[model samples]
Target: MSEKRKLAFSKANYLIMIAGIIVLAIGFIIMTLDSEPYGFGFLGLTLGPIVVMLGFAIEFVAIFYKPKSKSDTE
Candidate 1:
């Protein structure tokens, strides 16, 4: 008899999730780089939010992405 096995997500999925988290961290760091008072400079006011949103988008994609099975590809 063979034992049945399954995983919630693949290694690739976790790698993507890690990348997204790294992106999010970079976005926050970019915001902190702003020299303006209260972080009102272009990085904080515009680039930061955009980057954060992109990070979130990446996270969303990573969470939903499904890798094709070896059999499927064949």
Candidate 2:
């Protein structure tokens, strides 16, 4: 059996990941600032980690998953 090749990430994917990180940072800052309870800031606190984790999951999927080549179907 032949070995399969790994997929490589595109430049756009990296840019998206970077943007996600920036958004996550902003969310964290908003969450940490003094603010009223049960408000937008509190929402940020809940959303920040979820957004960051989603970003990482997207990156992981991009890096590890690929469609099989036509030749591989034989």
Candidate 3:
């Protein structure tokens, strides 16, 4: 039988995705920790959103990033 084609993401991609998810979760947590009324504190109003955007950027990069194979490096 012919070998099945592998999926796009390699191990590094998976790792990056997991890290992105963790970052995203931390962003949510940071937002929740805000003390100002209606979550208007720094963590919520600024830092949290920035972190979330960073996480999303990471995820997007991970999805598009392709590792070089030995043959490709030649």
Candidate 4:
């Protein structure tokens, strides 16, 4: 891959990681702030973080977790 391609991939990976952290934080805040143990608002709050984490996980798989081809090793 070219240098530009590597840089672009790195940028995307960081963006996904940051997004995941933000989502997890939001979820934690919502879950903590709720008066009720379980409610729609609380559920909604949790969903944001869950989706963020999933996005991060998917990005991670696409980036750092992929199996390397023979060309990649060379």
Candidate 5:
């Protein structure tokens, strides 16, 4: 008898990963929008990097996230 194969990540996890990627994109965009001649402004030097790091953190969470199963609640 053959059994169905399961995917590595759940739908929620994939959604979270997508969100993370979007956040990363937003951070990069913010950096590019900085008015400083060489991107030395606050957005380029601080906020943008912080947002990008947050995005990476979100991705890390998504990669390790596991939904609770009915059996696990017992």
Candidate 6:
């Protein structure tokens, strides 16, 4: 008999990935909204990139995240 296989990622991981994508989009939008020429101002040069990096970090965490199984909880 063949055994059923479980998914590699859980629902929570997918949600976290979606959140990371949204954050990345927001960061790009922020950079676009910068008033300075050629995106040289703080938002474009600093804050936007920071947010983007954070988004990437979130995505990394999501990819590696492992939820505790019921057996582990008990």
Give the higher-TM-score candidate: 1 or 3: 3
lDDT, each prediction? 0.93, 0.62, 0.93, 0.59, 0.95, 0.95
Model 1's TM-score against the true structure: 0.88
Worst-scoring 10-residue span by lDDT in model 6: 1-10
lDDT of 2 by residue, 1-74 (tens): 59977437556556666766676676566556636565455445566556656666766655655557689999
Scored by lDDT, model 4 comes in at 0.59
Between 4 and 5, whose lDDT is larger? 5
For candidate 5, write residues 1-74 as lDDT tens digits.
49988899999899999999999999999999999989999999999999999999999999999988899989
- The lowest-lDDT stretch of 10 consecutive residues in candidate 5 is 1-10
Off by over 4 Å in 1: 1-5
Q: Which pairs of residues collide in model 3?
A: none
Lowest lDDT sum, 10 consecutive residues, model 1, at 1-10
Q: Per-residue lDDT for 1-74 in model 3, tens only? A: 69998876899999999999999999999999999999999999999999999999999988988888899978
**Judged by lDDT against the true structure, how good is candidate 1?**
0.93
lDDT of 6 by residue, 1-74 (tens): 59988788999999999999999999999999999999999999999999999999999999999888899977
User: Which lDDT value does model 6 have at 31?
Assistant: 93
| TM-scores vs. true structure, each candidate | 0.88, 0.47, 0.91, 0.44, 0.92, 0.89
Angstrom error of the Cα, residue 52, model 6: value is: 0.2
lDDT of 2 at 52: 59
lDDT of 1 by residue, 1-54 (tens): 598686788888999999999999999999999999999999999999899999
Among all candidates shown, the one with the greatest TM-score: 5
Better of 1 and 2 by lDDT: 1
